[model samples]
Target: MPRLSLALSLLAVLVPAAYAQEAAPATSPKITVDPRAIVDSMPQQGTLLTGLYATQATIELCSVEAGEPATTAMNAHRRQLESEMRMDDATSAAAYAAIKGDVEKAGVDCAEGSKDRQQTAEVIAIYSGAGATPAQPASPMDPAAPAPSATPADPAAPATPATPAQ
Candidate 1:
């Protein structure tokens, strides 16, 4: 029937228009990180990644197989971790020792994060240097414009209104 066809046509046009209006997000979602999750996951060392990468970095100098003295290696490892984790020397040493023990006990080179790492609270927010925010909805008065191309625009083309002779 004509009524059915008209209703279908109206729905097709209306639904798309409604979706287009809400397509843009108002704000970007902030980064959320769970400490336990980060410790459990393994990250490939010497790899490059952008944004808030949830990767683990461990210092295994405390292992007996290393040719260095136990205290010496531990101190060096603690120092490295302190700088990396932005923690004090004592806290960093404790954190490193905690992980080192876990790895050694398992007779393996890697281990997951342990509960002894008291430094990690239940949840934490991590901010990566690479900034990425969700696209915001365009204003009704002014529509959004596409990014400019790499090639320069024509010099003669006037972007703004021509200034009257003063």
Candidate 2:
């Protein structure tokens, strides 16, 4: 009977530790999220996407370090970037492009941290509205429209034109 009780106690103490270990990884952060859902659901498409990307990256880094819950880390990251960057849809779009480049570079940096990866202009093409450079703002004032002359054209200057070269 003593042996049975000792076995039960051992199980009680060790089972929880084993269960705790099983749950340990869950506590760590997650990098990937349902980006599409977030993007589609957000009222501000541009800002959310950018913010999401930045948050994901931050969560990944934090997870790699502190091993906190991914969702917690993700929320913290989103708040941090939103506050620190003060980004709107337009700004967020711009930022996402930049962040994507940085994160890609980070991967290489982690592996080699030596050689420089040269990025070409083609690789960094900016896709503004409609995948075309945002239509040059239709100049409000027409270029063809004549601009007013500064000097009240020396009307006399032209008239003195032919002092008949006497």
Candidate 3:
């Protein structure tokens, strides 16, 4: 009877210990996130043009580090944006230079398992074909109709141009 009780006690302790060992979560590798780095990497301006330029710069940096998948995704995104807002060669170059400079200043590092690298992958995934729908081009205006005001109702306000039909 004593042996039976001892055996039961051992089993109770061992079973719970074994279960606890199995239930414990595995430790994951530490990931450091820098808020300043994240902020620095972001687009300086809220304009669509700035966003497009930032995307291009991100692609350029990620392509070299993250490889072909990044390149493919970024290129597709670039094409989509370009189809919407066609920029001339000089403008494109200038925009790229400015964006690239900001990115460089931000110290973007696309090394494997890095925060920036993960962010780049996420950007590629999100901005690639499936994520955002392109804006529909405005319909052609009837030339005979009176021309709409080029200036805003408030003279001090800047005029926002209608999106050109693609």
Candidate RMSDs in Å, in order, are 21.1, 26.9, 21.3
Q: Any runs in candidate 2 off by more than 4 Å, and if so which? A: 1-68, 105-166
Clashes in candidate 2: how many?
2
71 in model 3: Cα distance from truth in Å?
Answer: 4.4
Predicted candidate 3 versus true structure: per-residue lDDT over 1-166, tens digit per residue: 9999999999998999999989999899999997667354433333555665665676577673534565676566555555555666676677679888998898888677786666555555564434422234444584544567766689987777899999
Candidate 1 vs candidate 2, TM-score winner: 1
lDDT of 1 at 83: 57
Error at 122, model 3, angstroms: 0.9
On TM-score, the leading prediction is 3
Tell me which residue pairs clash in candidate 1. Answer: none
| Residue lDDT tens for model 1, 12-78 | 9999999987996678789989766746243332111200111122222322232234335334544
**Model 2 reaches what TM-score against the true structure?**
0.23
| Candidate 3 structure lDDT | 0.65
- The worst-scoring run of ten residues by lDDT in candidate 1 lies at 46-55
Residue lDDT tens for model 2, 1-166: 9999999999999999999989877555667777565444444644554646743554343332322343454456555665565667687566666876777666633222222211111111211111223324545497755567776567667534545565
Query: In model 1, which runs have C-alpha deviations exceeding 4 angstroms?
Result: 1-78, 108-166
In candidate 3, stretches whose alpha carbon ends up further than 4 angstroms from where it belongs are 1-49, 62-73, 76-86, 127-166
